[model samples]
Target chain A: MAQIEIRDLGIDYRKPKSNEVFSAVDSVDLSVEKGEFVTIVGSSGCGKSTLLMAVAGLVDLTRGSIEIDGKRVDGPGPDRAVVFQEASLLPWRSVRGNVKFGLEMQRWSGGDLNERAMQMIRLVGLGRFSDYHPHQLSGGMRQRVNIARALAVDPEVLLMDEPFGALDAQTREIMGTELLRIWERAKKTALFVTHDIDEAIFLADKIVVMGRNPGHIKEVIKVDLPRPRNESILDSDAFHELRKRLRAHLAEDMSSMQLVQEVA
Target chain B: MIAEFFYRRQALVLGTLSMIGIVVFWQIAVDTGFINPFFISTPSQVAAEFKVQFEDGSVATNVAATLYCFVWSLGLAALVGTILGMLAGWFADVESALEPFIWFKYSAPTVAFYPLFVAGLGYGTPTIIAIAFLFALTPIYANTLSGIKNTDRDLARAARSFGARPLDIFLRVALPGSVPVMMAGLRLGVGRALTGVVVAELFGANAGLGYAITYYGQLMQTTKMMVSIVIVIALGVLLTQILSFLETRTDSWRVDSGR
Candidate 1:
């Protein structure tokens, strides 16, 4: 049985200024095995983040259902944790306090909550900054704190929505590498969303590509890359081949979107 | 050696010197008959009056009366304003219902309602406190409403994703996020409440700094009246300074770098 099962899921949002309700995601089906790392990649408005949010139970599903361990997902639960794009650390809290927030919410009484939060902070390589507030840290450091906060609760599944999207290219790459290391040690099922192709390929056991205009999954490619992948793989031939295939898939969607624009 | 010390503490030194210079100039002017002491009074005469008032305990009695009204009115205003503001911010219906009335009370001359309060509560401490409460309530309510309404959406969303219940989200995310602005509201309320107390005392109160000012003025005791005036100004500065210190303490997170 899959650890996470999302079948024929759909989501719709009403326009802010208009009464029209439009589908943000539709008929999306995916299965994530235990401890598997899956990445979802698409352009902005492709509903990739929406799909991730549905799995995290933050968004209400309009059609079908999402199940974890064969149980239906209705709302946010302690079994899952999410890392938002903006880091979203509370400005009033220090790194350790922000990390402890999830545990505090869950009413976690399993031994010492402070110790658990401190462990996660150190895991994210921010031990020295445990007492630093959000504003005292750089953008990349803030996102690391966000990741630490999510992981502190010891959730079964980790969901990320462009966790490093706001970071510079160099910092983003470093974070990706650090995330994989953490994922290996933590050994939890992770579903990451990103627009960076190399990021998606480097970190996933499978890559799900989505298209916009009533979003649907276009393809799911199984990555043949070996474990403990490094930056050097990005320069390899096989990595380039996979990148080319993914680029073609995205380019087709872009041109189709342009054609739709022209028609309108 | 002294240059660096003076440069570092320039504002304190300059402010103190400027104040002393003004008092000295005023004393010289009064002594030389350039300004009539009967009308304006000399700095030394005012100081002598302050000593007499302090020794005889009149200053203590009047200050206590004014402070009694100020504290009660400000406390009730803060409590009532915060509760109503939170309700209005959370519920659209509550906001819509309260909007017009709040604006009316905020913009209208609150002093105009003093006669009605005096008639209802009967011209004493109760009436004085009521008038001051009404004056201080609006800014606190307004700031809290805007603060809650403008809480960072991203923080709330993050808390929701962490499985925080609605109550948890409100208390932990929304309330804490709104505190800086709420403190600002409290600061404004302090100033307004002080003004309200003085104004109310001017009209109806029998024992307060404001009443003393009026009494001494009618008796043509300029030096005694100046004592009350100086106390009122000092109280305003002291209260606002304390609130500003607290505001900055709560604001440590928003400020970058310099702890």
Candidate 2:
């Protein structure tokens, strides 16, 4: 059975002033088997993050259902953990404290909790700076701690929404490499969302391309590139061909979206 | 060595020198008959009165009474104001309910209502404490409301996504997140609370530093009146310093944010 199953899920939020309901995610059906790495790529308003939020049980489903490990999700649960784009570590908490946050929320106790948190911190290569607060660290280091916090829960599904969106290009690539290395060991079912096509291709086993106006999946392309993927893959003919394909799909959607906008 | 000390501590040196200069100038003016000693007490005369009041222990008693009223009223106001403000900030209905009264309390002359408090509480320490509490509550309530309202939505959402219950999110995130601004509110409340205690004591009570000031002034004992006024001023400076120290320590995380 798939670790996560979303069957025809929809999310509608009411506009505060207009009192009109707008659909953010419409009829989105996807499933992730255990230990699979999936990425959703789209434009700004494509509802990709909203879809991820629904899967994490942080948003109300307007239609259908989300099942995690064969159980319908009611609200946020210990089985799923989310990593945010801004690396929202509590400013007052040190690196170790931030990593321990999810475990603490899950009512984890004993010395093993500390052991698990420290191990994740070390996995992310933040061992030397465990005692430092979020504000003291660089942006990339903070995102590493953010990843560590999500991973510490030993969740069945790890949902991430542009987790490295704020980092510089160079730092983003380094963190991406580190993330893949970390995933090699922990191998939890991962669903990542980003607009950067290179990032989606590099990190994902299968990339789900989404389109905006009412937000639904457009295509699901399998990334057949071999792993362990490194910077060398960027120069390969196969990698270039795949990147070209993804770009064409996205550009076609963008032009068609602009045409619809002009008519409306 | 003296120059080095003076250079390193310019503010302390300048403040001490200015105070000494004023005292010397005032004493010279009175002794030379430029000002009447009976009407305007010299520094030495005020010092003598302070010594006499200290010897008789009236000064200590008055200080204790004022300190008691200030501490109790401010402490209670801090607790009540923060809880109410957190609720108002967290829930829209609570905020709406409090909006009108908060505006009224903030804008009205709270000291003018001291008579009503004295009428109900029967003119004693309780009345003074009540007056201080009423005066101090507005700033704390306003700041705490804003603090909680302005807490990072991302952090709260992140906590929620981690299976944190509402109560845990409040206790662990909202409360700590709002603390720096709440401390700022408490600092503002300290000044208003001092005013409250003085107004109530002067009008209704026979004890406290405020009463002592009025008592000495009515008797035309200019030196003792000056002493009491000095004590109040000293107390204000001391309390403000203590609160500032505490605020800095509590918000040590803000050092990196440069807030």
Candidate 3:
């Protein structure tokens, strides 16, 4: 059975005086099986992040409900953990304290929160900076802590919004592989949002392609590729084909957008 | 290091030069008999009177009394105002309810209504201190509320997503964010308190520097009056400068506009 359900999800973004009343995520229906990684790929401003936030109960849905385990999600709960693009670690908190923050919120007692925090910090390979504050670490290390903090809750669903999109090409590749390794160990149902086609192909068990300007799901492609995926997978025929397909689909949209803008 | 020292030295030199010029003209006016010696004494004569006053211990007692009022009033005002300000900032109802009453207290010329405070708190240094306390509280309360309200919402949201509880967010984030603005209010409050103390003493006190100057002037003791006036001016300037220095030191992260 699917862990989440997004049905007839039409979102209208109404700002004060602007005449644009376009639906950001238009009548989108998507679901996640118990332990699957689903990636939503689109151009910038295509409401991919909006869709993920809706599922995490961060973004208010204009006309739909997102359900988790037969229960409707009305607000953000500890059951779903989200990692944002910029790795929003609380500036004053040490990495260790940040991981423990969520657990402490649920009133988890005594030394248990400490042990769990330490365990997760070690898992993310940020044990060295456990005592260090967020401002002390580099961007990549901060995002790792963000991932660790989310996982510390032992959440049923993990929502990642461009978690590695800020990194350089090499660092991005390394973190992506590391993310999968951690996800495999933790084994949580995940919904990831990204603008990169190759990234969506590399990390996802299923990839949902999004179209811009009142964003709607253009295609949902099943990856069907074997995992415990490594660097060599990028050179494989199956990997190349999936990448090419998503890339071609996005490229056509980009050209059409340019043409339309020029005409208008 | 040498350049920084030179810069400070130049600033001292420029300021001292102007003060010396003013004193020189005043002395010349008295020495040349342009102003009667009985009405306007020279700086040298005031220095001589200061030595006599110091030996008699009247100057020491008066200085001590004035300092006492300045400190006592300022301390209570800061303590009370901060508590009220934090309450006002945190709760909307408290802010709206207390705002108009506070505005009336702040806007009123405190000197015009000195009799009320005198009637309530009574005479000597205590009355002076109460005046300073009332004078200093408003700006601190208002600025503290403004500072807390103006804190960056983005930074707050980031902290919220990390699962920090309400109290933790306030203590760790909100308070630190408010430090730069709070320092501004504190500087103004301390200055206003010192001014209030002097005004109170001038109006009603029996044993302060303000009382000594007025008492001496009325008796035509021009040298003694000059000395007392110098001390009063110095006391106000010294207190303001010290508080400002401490303000910059405590919250040095703000951009130094030097205004």
Candidate 4:
């Protein structure tokens, strides 16, 4: 059995001002293996983030179920940690403190909490910034702290929802590279959600493409890239081929999105 | 040499110089007969009266009485406001139930109810404390409510994803996040509660700085009255300064966001 199995999962959200209930995710089925790095790519409102949130047990399912280690997921647990789109560090805490928040919450008795947090901070190359507050760091640095905080919990699975979405292109690429390096070292199952195609192909073992209008997976493309991938892969033929295929899928999604917009 | 010292501590030097200048100017004006000392007493006269009051122990007694009421009022306001505000912020029903009453107390002239308090509790420390408590309660409640309500949703969400229970979220996330705002509320409460204590003393109290002010004013002893006024002003400044110092210390982690 897969490490994390999501079967026919569905989620619905009620309109804030209205009583209307609408589906956000529907009939979604996906499974992640142990230590696999999977990326989900889609346009905004495609429910890709919603799917990730469900797997993280942050959202309630309207239908179907999600299971981890053959146990049905109910609510957020210490078994998985989520890296939010925003590096949601507590403004009142230093980098080390933010990193230790999850461990403190879990009542983790694995070792000294401060030592574990410091180790994760150093792993993310933020050893010099252990005492810095969230606001003192740059956007890239803040996201690195967020990643470190998630990893500090020593979770079996890591969920990232566009962890670098708020960053510039150059910074985003750098973070992506950095993330893969961290993932390699941590060796934990990771589900990263992003809209950047190159990012999807570069870091992912398999890319799950999602479509909106009651969001569902359209396809899952297995990335054939070798290990220890670097920036040079962006200039390679195989990378271009995969990028082209992903682009085609997105183009199709965009046109369909425009049609839905016109209909609305 | 002096310029270097002044530049190193400009604010401190300037503030001290300005205060000394004002007192010297006032004394000079009174001595030169440019201003009437009978209506607004000279700085020296006020200082003399202060020394006399200090020696007689009336200053100490009155100050202690005023401070006693002020402390009780502010302490009760902080405790009750924080508890109620937390409930109001966390539960929609509690907030809606409190909304109208809180707004009413906020906008209404709270001092006008002093007569009612006097009738219920009788004139003295109880009445004085009640008035001051009313004055201080609203700001503390409002600020704590806003602080808890405005706690960053992202932070709470992050905490939740880490398996933090509701109590954990409240204690670790919401309480700490709300500290800066709650401290601001306390600062405002400090001023308002002081005002309330003095106002109550001015009307019905037998002791306190406010009573001293009224007594000296009626006797046409401007220097003595000015002594009490100066003490009140000094108390206000000192309390606010202490709170501002605490605010900065507690909020040390907050820096201007680069993003």
Candidate 5:
């Protein structure tokens, strides 16, 4: 059985400037098996984050429903945890404190809370910096804490909206590799959103290409490359071929709106 | 030492120079009888009188009465105003419902209403405390309501996502988030209450620093009157500094995102 099933999900929000109804996310349907890692890749303002918010139940659904393991997504619950792009950590808390905060909310008690939090801190390669506050952490280290905080809850569905989006290219690549290593051990269902096609290809079993200007899905290409993926995989024929196909698809999609071609 | 001196030197030097100059001028004036020693008491005369008052235990009763009024007004107003403000901030309808009463209490000349206080509560410690409470409440109410209202909704939503119930959101997120703002209110409140106590005591009370000023001034003991005024001002400054120090220490966990 599918661990999460999202059917014809739609989200509408107020445009901040004026009195106009707009769709941030339009009719979309997707499903994730219990352990499959899916990545949604899109341009900026493509409503990929909004889609993640819908899955997390932070935003209201205008149409359709999402079921997490046969239970409908009502208001936000502990079962689904989200990692925001900006590492929305509680600044007052230390690394361990932030990680343990979820467990605290879940009514965890005794040394188990500390033990569980420490383990996750170690998992994120932040064990040495356990006592450091979020303000003391670098962008990469903070994102690591963000990921660890999400995983600490032992959530079934991990929703990440470009968690490493703001890091430098080098740091982002390192984090991508680190994420795969952690995901393999945890084996949690993930729905990650990123603008980087390479990041999507490297992290996801299924790369969902999204197009903005009404926010619609462009393609959903399944990456056939097997697990424990490495940098050498980027040079492989299959990886190059898949990247070529997606690029062609994006280029063709952009051809109709060729005014952007000059800039691209 | 040089860098530190340069960093603070101008203000420090000016302050020290002013202090030295005032003392020098005061000593010379008293020696030359330039200013009447009885009316404009030099700092030395006041200090000597303070020592006399201290030895005789006269300062204690006045100090105690002033402190009692301070504690009464501060404690009662803070508790009532803060709770009411929290409630009003939490629920919009409550804010609107109580707006008139809160506004009236805030804007109406509390000092002019001194007669009403004396009429109802009588000219005693309670009346003085009541006046202080009235002056102190407006800031506490306004700041508290704003503090709770201004708590980041994003954090509240984030807490809610983590299975935080309404109580948890209020206690952990809203209340802690409101601490800095609430502390600002408390600082303003203490200052206002001190002023109120002085006013009420002057008009209604037979003892306390305000009474000391009045009792001495009526007998043309200007030096004693100035001494009482100085004591009240010093008390205000001391209390403000202590509360502000506590605020900085306790709310250090918070980020002032300027939100």
Candidate 6:
């Protein structure tokens, strides 16, 4: 059984004055098995992030339904956690405090709560900075805290929207590896959305390539490359071949969109 | 340790020196007859009046009165204003309804309402407190409202996604996030509260610093009047320093918390 399932999902934004409905995501069907890693890659306006939001129950579906653990999603629940592009750490909280925020909201208590939060902080390599505030840490460190906060809740599914999009190339790569290491340990189903094809390939068991013009799925590609993935894998022939194939699909999707526009 | 101490106390030393310089200049002006002592009072004369007031217990009574009024009024203003402001800030319809009145209260001369307060409350500490509460409430409301509005939506959304209820998000995310601006509003309100106290007492008050200043000034007791005026100024400076100390603590939290 799928951990998360989206069938014919659609989201529309209606202008308040004109009442003209614009489709952001239309007729998208996808599913993630338990412990599977899925990445959605698309250009801007492809509604990839919107799809992730729907799965996280942050967005109301204009049509169809999303089911998680074989139950329909009505609103946000503890079964899933989302990591935003920005770290979004509360300024008044230390790193450990921030990690514990979700747990506190979930009514978790006792000494084990602190112990679990500290374990998550250490998991993200922020053991020393657990007491530090978000501003004192580097951008990468902040994102690490953001990830730890999500993971600490022990949610069955993790939804991430360009979690490392704000980082520099070096930091982004490093975070990607760190995320895999943590994900391997947690073994939770993950649905990640990003515009970076390399990031998608590096982190995903399967990649869903999205396209604009009503934001529909263009293709779903599987990464045949072996893991545990490392920097050396980027130099491998299989990685290059996969990268070329994903790029070609993206380019084709763009031209087809342009063709549709021209025909109209 | 000595160097660190000096660095920490530099502002205190400078402030004291500047105050001494002003007193010396005032004394010179009075001795040379450049300014009449009858109108302005010499530094020594003002100090003597202060000593006399202290000995007779009038200064203590007036100080207690003013502090009493300030504490009650400012405390009420902070409490009521923050609650209403947070509600208005969190809810759209409440904000829209209250916005016009808030702007009117903020822009109008608060002193004009003292006469109305006096008429309603019948000329006592209640009247004075009403004036202070009226004047001080607006800044606290405005700051909290804007602070709630300016809070990072992403943070709130993140909380919501983690299954945080509305109240939890408001208390944990919105309230703490709004503290910096709320403190700023309180600072503004504190100054306004002081003005409110003076306006109320000046109109008709039995025993307060403002009443003392007006009473002595009308009788041409320049030294006595100067003593009251100096005390009022000192109170303002002291209150501001205490608030500034609070602001610095919040500042450290902001810097480290990534706010």
User: What lDDT does the true structure give each of the candidates?
Assistant: 0.91, 0.89, 0.81, 0.92, 0.84, 0.88
CA lDDT for candidate 2 = 0.89
DockQ of each: 0.69, 0.61, 0.19, 0.72, 0.39, 0.67
Task: Please give the lDDT score at residue B128 for candidate 3.
Answer: 88
lDDT of 4 at B183: 90
lDDT digits (tens) for residues A38-130 of candidate 3: 999988768898888777666678897788998898766777888877646655468998787667665655458878999999999998889
Model 2 - which docking category? medium
Lowest-lDDT window of 10 residues in candidate 3 chain B? B250-259
Tens digits of per-residue lDDT for model 3 on B1-259?
8788768799887789889998999889988889888877888898998999999999898888888888898899889878788778777788999988797896788776688877887877778888888889888888788877676675455455545567866776677767667777888898788778877887878787877877877798888877878888887788778867777665543334342
Which regions of candidate 6 deviate over 4 angstroms?
A16-18, A109-111, A252-264, B1-19, B256-259
**Per-residue lDDT tens digits of candidate 4, residues A1-264?**
999999999999999989799899999999999999999999888999999999998899999999999999999988899999764889899999999999999899999999999999999999999999888889999999999999999889999999998999999899989999999999999999999998999999999999988999999999888989889999999999999999998889888766666567
For residues B1-259, write the lDDT of model 1, one tens digit per residue.
7899889999988999999999999999989989999998988888898999999999999999999999999999999999999988777789999999887896789888888987788987998899889889998999999888887888888988888888998899889988988999999999999999998898877899988988888999999999999999999999999999999889889854268
Full-model lDDT, candidate 6: 0.88
Worst 10 residues of 4 chain A by lDDT: A255-264
Off by more than 4 A, model 4: A258-264, B1-35, B257-259
lDDT of 2 by residue, A1-264 (tens): 888888998899999999999999898989888998999998878899999998888899999999988999879998899999764788888899899988888887546877898999999999999999888889999999999999998888899999999999999999899999999889888999999989999998999999877999989989889989898888889878878988987887788666666557
Task: Identify the candidate with maximal TM-score.
Answer: 1
TM-score of each: 0.94, 0.92, 0.76, 0.93, 0.89, 0.93
Native-interface RMSD of candidate 4: 1.2
Interface RMSD of 6: 1.3
lDDT (10s digit) by residue, model 4, range B53-104: 9999999999999999999999998899888998998777999999998978
Question: Judged by DockQ relative to the true structure, which candidate is superior, 4 or 5?
Answer: 4
Clashing pairs in 3: none
Residue-level error in angstroms, candidate 2, position A108: 2.4
Number of the predicted model whose DockQ against the real structure is largest:
4
- What CA RMSD would you report for each candidate? 2.5, 3.0, 5.2, 2.7, 3.5, 3.3
Better of 1 and 3 by DockQ: 1
Query: How high is the lDDT of residue A160 in model 4?
Result: 95
